[model samples]
Target: MNPIDTLNLDFRALSTFLAVLDEGSVSRAAVRLGVTQSAVSHTLERLRQALGDPLFVKSGRGIVPTRYALQAGPHVRQILDDLQSLSAGPPFSPATAEFTFTIAANDYQRDLLLPGLVKTLRREAPGISLQVIPSGIPSAEMLRKDACDLIVSPHAPEATDIMQRGLMADRNVVFYDPDYRKPPENLADFLKSDHISLVFGTGERPSFEISLNARGLTRRNVVTVSNFSGLPEFLRGTDMLATAPQLMSKHLLRDFAWVPLPFELKPFTLLMLWHRRNQNDPAHKWLRNQVNAVAAAMNKLNP
Candidate 1:
């Protein structure tokens, strides 16, 4: 028989053949497959005609596989396994894949996460390029439209349909200049101090204010900045104290002094957010794992 002609056999027939072989009876195979016994027998007939072999035959009460059927079973099983892996998408190969990933993160994250991530990428996958953008309205929209690959943020917006994984936990710290004398003992004292608020964008301000209102204190914002990088600079000359993620403030505290926020607030969970479309993508999965690993390592070091 020509090889091309042999390739014309129906996959359904092969599946039915395997089912019958495994079940040891057509009736059992039909029940397993939710089909009539006659249909299973008919499928076996077609498979036998295509292969030019009596793939299985009656031997007493149970069906017996012929030599050809026994030989073909493992090969058929391997083929099906390979097809299933392909459907799920194969594992990522970082060395050969030339792909660009766009990530959204705030400036504080850019300071803490990107430095270590970049060093690892340079050593491992030099071809993969990364674009980091400010996390805000644009980032949320980009994620929804599948324009951005991932987002690293303290809190994910509820409006977007994105999957989030907690990367690291950090509390909000109140940062002040070293020479600033007033040390706050509680929420009332903290509220009395001038504050510099870090606003990602216009949308974040309302939610942030609402969260503060729930605590029975309204933030009397002396100044608002677009990025966290400016917070350190803004603190140098003014009495204004800044509230930011602990990890980011930890890096800044090398040159400045800070204290824990007096009011009881939830610890910030920095999360990685990605659209559902790329949830199972091999390359995307690899990147997500790398980020998770880095965050885990950093947490271990700090804790």
Candidate 2:
């Protein structure tokens, strides 16, 4: 029989095939899909018969996709994504909707936007809950893999399928405790003082740090925390300084004092990102509008 004529797979089989291809094991794919190993095996058998290829082959103790499966993966994924977009069928009413939206964001963006978002949801859509996850240098795959519905960050990963909008812009400022030390008045004073900085898990340096290093300006970094939330504890009682976005002073670092950086640095804009598939969905569009409104209000308040 012709392979095209034999193809009679349903959405479930296609989904299971992609799951196994991604997890590289029937057992692991079963766990991901919340099905038994035998069920996953049965689905794969159907997919193999339909496609006229053994999609996965045992490689050592694990499994790997064959060339045909590898070639078919993107097409299958696009098909599923298109089908998902179709599920957003009826006009969405926030007041009656009941679903959880998972968003990927770091502490800085989380503290800056989520609280306001929570309030808006409570007032407008009480049934819709939110799940916030850490966004480590936002990637398009996070959306494609269904890892998150949205991502808020300063960095937007380059991808044709990902869409982004600028939320707010803030200049870098020096954060310190007034009781512990006075603000540095000059570049020499700024560089001489010990510093506390954020170093993310990805080991990517912030733009200001990269620019500073390129200019041959180095501060004495006495402490490096993994996230912005960890900065205040290390800085509260010491003479150390941290360079962070000025907008943080209103929320996460509200108790602390912040001053203009001794040296000039360009402002960074926070961006909200989502997959293009979600761009036209009414519910997703509503959430994006709320985030945009919150960012606008924050900009007005700070300006």
Candidate 3:
């Protein structure tokens, strides 16, 4: 398109483009924008003419964005964000503003970090609600798909669209019930006992287990559970030891004793990850700050 044509293009068409991309259908975009299907179609036509591309094309049963559309989306979202900030309203008040925030957390981190976060939110941001989903391996695609507002986990996602900050670093520890057995004093004792392993994903090994295997060492994994919360049940009344992050202290109240792992293992760093789209959102920023503060306090206690 010519400079004149570009200048004449309605900025509203970008909103239509974004809505259509987000909703994946013209009719849905119209509903989200409180407009008619014809209006959305008209906007798309104008955008196709101005931008010299189909922008969106019919797929099997729905429309898929063209390469150009996908490429332009982040910039378009940022443009709209800048415009909204230009006409910014009164400062954000969490106490009065109601929002449903979603986060992806591993069971251990969820148990460790969320209690403090929820406590603060209840007293301060009473109107806000939190939704927590299980965190497997966090990915950039997960963020782009709006899978969660933030991800709290040890593995950093390798997507350019996602940004992350280190929350804490944790080492492995042996957890065992005193009634059933004592803490392992060395690697030989640790290897002799049966073990419970927390498997975050199917067919995947835990870091501590992998580390042990790297040194030609292996333990008898008698019980395998998906989350740290389930470790106690499997370890109780048995001579099984579970090696997990130190953060488990915040979540576990069972009559369990813990000691540092007898074998050398690398520590894992927990991270807070979010999409760039929500990076500048005031409410998102505030929530991130609050969570970061919570992480800092927890790190001090655990570290």
Could you tell me the lDDT of residue 234 within candidate 1?
A: 74
Each prediction's TM-score versus the true structure: 0.65, 0.73, 0.73
| Comparing 1 and 3 on TM-score, the stronger one | 3
CA RMSD for every model? 13.8, 5.6, 5.9
Which residue ranges in model 3 land beyond 4 Å of their true spot?
1-84, 87-89
What tens-digit string does per-residue lDDT give for candidate 1 at 99-174?
7888887777777887778777787888888889777643444675556799887767663235789988887777
Candidate 3: the clashing residue pairs are none
- Candidate 2 regions with alpha-carbon error over 4 angstroms: 1-87
When 2 and 3 are scored with lDDT, the better candidate is 2
What is candidate 3's local distance difference test score? 0.82
lDDT of 2 by residue, 36-148 (tens): 99999988887788777998998899888999998998898788777777887888999999999999999999999999999999999999999999999887678877899
Clashes of each: 0, 0, 0
lDDT of 2 at 117: 97
lDDT of 3 by residue, 1-303 (tens): 463466344467777888888778999789767789999998888788777889999999999999999998888888877876665577889889898999999777888888889998999999999999987877765676787999998888665457898988887788888887778888898898888887767456688887888898888888888877788778778888888877675567346788999977878888999986677778888999999999899767765
